[model samples]
Target: MKTSDTTDDLRQKLTHELARKRALLIDRHPNARNSLRIMLTALGVTDVHHAGRSVEVLRQVKAHHFDMILADYQLEDGRDSQQLLEELRQNHLVALSTVFIIITSERAYHNVVSIAELAPDDYLIKPFTADELHGRLIRALYKKHFFAQLYEQLDNGAFTEALSTCERLLGQESAFLFDALRLKGGILNALGRYAEATRVYQKVLEQRVVPWARMGLAMALRGQHQLAEAEDVGQSIVTEFPEFTAAYDFLAEVQQDLGKPVEAQEVLQRAAAISPNNSTRQRLVGDVAARNNDLATAEKAYGNVLRRRRGSSLKNLDDYSNLTRVMLDRGHAESARQVTDELRREWRGNRQGELAALIMDSLCAAKEGDAVKARHAVEKAILLHEALKAEGATTRVSQKMTVDLAQACLATGNEATAQEIVRQVAAENHEDRAMIAQVQRIYSKAGKAEKGQELLAQVGREIVELNNRGVLAARSGDLQGSVQLLVEAAERVPNLQFLVNATKAIFTLLELKGWDATLAKRGLRYLALAQTKDMRNPKVISARETYQRVARKYGVPIVPLGPSRSPESGPG
Candidate 1:
């Protein structure tokens, strides 16, 4: 335990760790990347990569797992390092164990609090010495090592195991106690134990007023359906710490759920103004603004979204369609036509993209009062839609696009086709208030409001009856009958609620009557489908836990609830 001996041990550890690491240097200029590469090489990192653009950074991260990433704050694509980090973490493209350091020239970067849910491991100021960089890497690697097990459990979708790990870490007096507490609150919230999550956040708040802890508490309150209280807390965070943009998003969601669309639109617009480069937030603003009949705002927000994602890998047909739809709504037929032309150019030969373009072309022609052109476009779109549906490629099309197509159909005098399309989408998304509202708007626009109401009521009644029958069968001790009925309902509707219910019923039956491979496989499929709809839903989590318990009892391998990603091996 002598000072000299401890120093020697640390030196050996650092040398070994650096030698085994794969490092990435991201900067707009070649000289900056070369300088950083030299520094990394001097520190014993032999595996070094360089990326000069944000797109290249994303490509490299997706293609390989790097142990260390050093990115400049100002990227060549106008995106900051903070935004890149947020995108990586949000999409689960980066592992939690990677040591990310922001290399910045601005001293203000060090003083600013990160508004993202995930913060970089460290910030490396310009003109820093190799020794300083070495020290930062060692500290970040040590923290990653300390939380290795918990990170693994979380990445593997083992929330219960991660919670236990958090508890064990909290039992000791370590520098990471607060970090462990933060993870514990998130895990509890993910598991739908909102009351416990609230208490954990409260405990953290008692010690200090942390923005993240307050945000966590607000989320817990929302999970418990305390919308008013959640809104109040969210407002406080926005007012007191205006830099914390995440609060704006949370508050907007709460407002939307509380049936305050106008308030939600206002909140999202404020956030978009503050973080104009955030494509996701811009898209949200566009959606809400369109829903509130604010066409000018909708057009601007959607235009921003398309501009931001124009040449990026994240660009999609939805972005182009959204802007075109807004333009058409504003009676800018020529503008909408231009956007549709761009869509065709950008997504050439892609079936879904072609379909989207055709639909938009039809809408544009109708708006321009060209009945012949509109009819021709509608016929082509109808043919493509049928072809995709027959080939089972319809699932690749977004629900929003499908609704838009139906609206086009109504505009083109294809009432039966529009009605059929709306009916199918409504049944599949019976619980999605937003989609339902969109469908209602389409019908109302066509002056068929009464017909839309009748259709929705019929779909709602059918779903309720189907679910009630399954419940009745279970209550009567006919477990087999209950499973059959529920599975049938899931196959027919395949919404989140039905999928979760079916999976739960199948797992319950398996628990009572021993494992049936066929039944378990079906249950897993439904659970996966439900997760695709909403991975963080309490119902999905509960269903996953039930399946895990049953699978363990029967000695079956449990599949992960989240998407599979490359696992990171800790430092050697």
Candidate 2:
């Protein structure tokens, strides 16, 4: 009788607290909402917000920070609650404090939840009692509150503080102990203490095979520059834990770092087959396919990204640009024209889009044997490039835009302008061997390889001399001069490691002495450029981690500098 009374009192307390929560309930069926409403009412939740569609739920989620969001896993519009969770998990609109609970009737939803990149705080299988629901909510809300500070510190780039918190929390026996260890490993990696991170991950693996921990182990190995070991671990994860979708990205990255783009592309293909609904994975598939000149696969992959990200905020222009390139390469003149026309129609005022569309228009025109129209379109593209010169564009965007322009000029019989543009491109990508090969391919396709080889070697020599000058400035203790010189060199030769490393060194010097806002922005911008040069490159990763340490000091967000591969998604 005493045990029953104690349970009753605890249940009553949870019901009362759950009642007081500012909550939202989402379900597609009216009967389902009625059933859930009755349960909430029985739990003393008198007031509840309701939405039937993903868009409606998103609107409410963006407008308010609710105490709880109970979303049905099954939904309309080809978007399940799992996709919605992934969408909002970017933290752009949803607050970290919000407790999300997935409500599902199907066992398939459980599988989806397991493989999802951004999982809900809790999930309630259908036919659950009001008491059971309340119990799960209590647990989830408690966890949200418990881990709030650690996440805040980490997101603000205070890795040192975050690390301290993780260590302190790990000392206590708790349900979140594994999470704490995982975060500790990440913090150690960000601090460039790869050896320490590897040890922590090893401890976790000895206890159990957790993909999150296993992924951390691979990352630590990669950070330590043990590519072979990292690949071994990554490949093992893929072979042993296929449901751990993150393994594919890690393995593919290792393959790319090992210069096996073909193998990496194959890994992504397998990942896409497993998770076709992921926009990031689709984009990556397109990227790797395009790099391998597999136009058919690239076209399909880019099309998938455009399809999947149709109504979401995560849609990127890169997909459209890449798709457009493939369409033109396939000799689909009318089709390519239609795409460029649509591009111009939508991105009317955007500089990069306008330039890209113009270049595409020129290419299509030239392919159709209209030299005059091609020349006109190429001129517009050149004018757009000149107009955007002073504005800062990402190296990826600039490289694609200029490369398109050069191809257009070459096709239009404008040899002088084409040569100048190729020279400029070669100069900028001086240290990027792959990019140089691509430039040579472009010239060879246009029957100008002799000129391309000459320009590549000349620009490479110029970049070497410029990098040396920047290094001398650093050795002389003229840190500011070193930064200025190296920044210039980096802009002229975006992937030149020596120049980027020198710039990073100056940024470190400034941070050690005192923070300069101007230098901080410059340093981060150069780091962004370096990352785009080689996503899996260890030097770039090290530079990014170092910047994260001082990111808090300089009031910068801890957001990554470039795009990331997706490890999430299965259709509902």
Candidate 3:
């Protein structure tokens, strides 16, 4: 394929394909964008768009999909190309099929590999000719075309089919064997076949010391609950490749799970220092620091999170509440009030924003000793919370915000309301140790640590009893009764465990008693809810596979597992 004649033939074909595709050029300077647009046009890419800022690029991506995106290394908003690429992929704004090329100067090119946590398909050095760009575009387009079927399956959430495609490619495509193995490892990990995924990654590592393969091996180890071994590999990666910021994040997660909060905070802080503009890592630093009772670090991290995302589309109500919570904790009541005011101004008509603002206002007023104002704000917040719950929008509210509301209720002498709110939250998130710790901290602040313990124990018991009843019924061969109990539990609590259980149970019943459209729909809804919580959970994947198998057997349509989104929200 690398022979001159074959390469020429492929380039000719790609040139024809380029004429029918759309492209986007992103550069801070107008002249640079124009020059790139001309080069693309010369290469037969006439349907070209240009953006001068990262925000503009985001807007264009949300409004329309492009076949190719070429962004300069440095963006106008202080974000580098790597950060933009990461954000787009993480939020599912861009498809894997899109060809992304970073255009970097010689000086920046040397550091690109070290700094990039999310690698682009290819990169072009500055001051290159149209022929050079054409050469790179043709190669990237060819690879993209080769994996088109696999990407389609992935985008559709058909993991099983995607895995099969990877296996086929691995056996046949000598040029793309490594690439197929990489995709196969990721798919296996996502489907929760950690043992097999571990083998795939290990096989790759045996051939060469690829960073991605090592990271995949670490993740596969983590999935198998081998936290100690995973931590060792993660530490080695960061030590050997200090510029790999993602290793810092992975190491921190492993440390946190291993009951090393101080270590976790330190690792995250290191990552944040290396990549200061990553709002997600900054938020994680804030969370871990707060849990460690390092209020000063927490305050700075949360402030950075808010500042980085201030005007971006990724900004949300939780950002405001996160900063305000730390500010109030640090006794910066006035500063907290200022942030709340900003939140109100930024989110004027959004109901969730109003709820967040009122809750923050109540906390600030309480901190300032204005009991009357605090009580008034709490009353308003309670009403809004009830309205949202009645409208079935409670899931839209973040767990952190719910904790803040409970804290506000406790501050304003509405102990009963606070207890009930915490009870419901505790019931739903009993498995999340961090969230439970947060709930306990709220109770401890209100001088009811003992009561919090009692309430959490009671919630735990109730959940276990509810789950056990369903399991026992299923064991006794009463599948119908088991489904009924599990469905009721899921509707009542809707936690990941219950939702997965209910979905699995319903599909089992359907397989036995013939498919009932109503029952199948209910099961699919539960599966979707579980995916929202954790898309890669082994149980969720198993449930999804079960539904697919049963649907195929009955010749019914199988719904894709991708999340539904509006046009404004970007690609599904």
Clashing pairs in 1: none
Give the higher-TM-score candidate: 1 or 3: 3
Q: Estimate candidate 3's alpha-carbon lDDT, on a 0 to 1 scale.
A: 0.86
Could you give me the TM-score of model 2 versus the true structure? 0.79
Rank the candidate models, highest lDDT first: 3, 1, 2
TM-score for each of the candidates: 0.94, 0.79, 0.94
The clash numbers for all candidates, in the given order, read 0, 0, 0
- Work out candidate 3's RMSD over C-alphas: 3.5
| Per-residue alpha-carbon lDDT of candidate 1 for residues 241-269, written as tens digits (9 for 90 to 100) | 77778888889989999999999999988
The models' CA-based lDDT, in order, is 0.85, 0.73, 0.86
lDDT of 2 by residue, 76-165 (tens): 756678667777754335555678888887667658766765657788887798879868877776666566777666544445677787
Please give the TM-score that candidate 1 achieves against the real structure. 0.94
2 or 3, greater by lDDT: 3
Once fitted onto the true fold, the runs of candidate 1 whose alpha carbons sit more than 4 angstroms away are 1-15, 110-114, 561-572
C-alpha positional error of residue 484 in candidate 3 after TM-score superposition, expressed in Å: 1.2
Best by lDDT: 3
What ranking emerges by TM-score with the best candidate at the front?
A: 3, 1, 2
- Estimate the Cα RMSD of every predicted model relative to the unseen true structure: 3.6, 5.7, 3.5
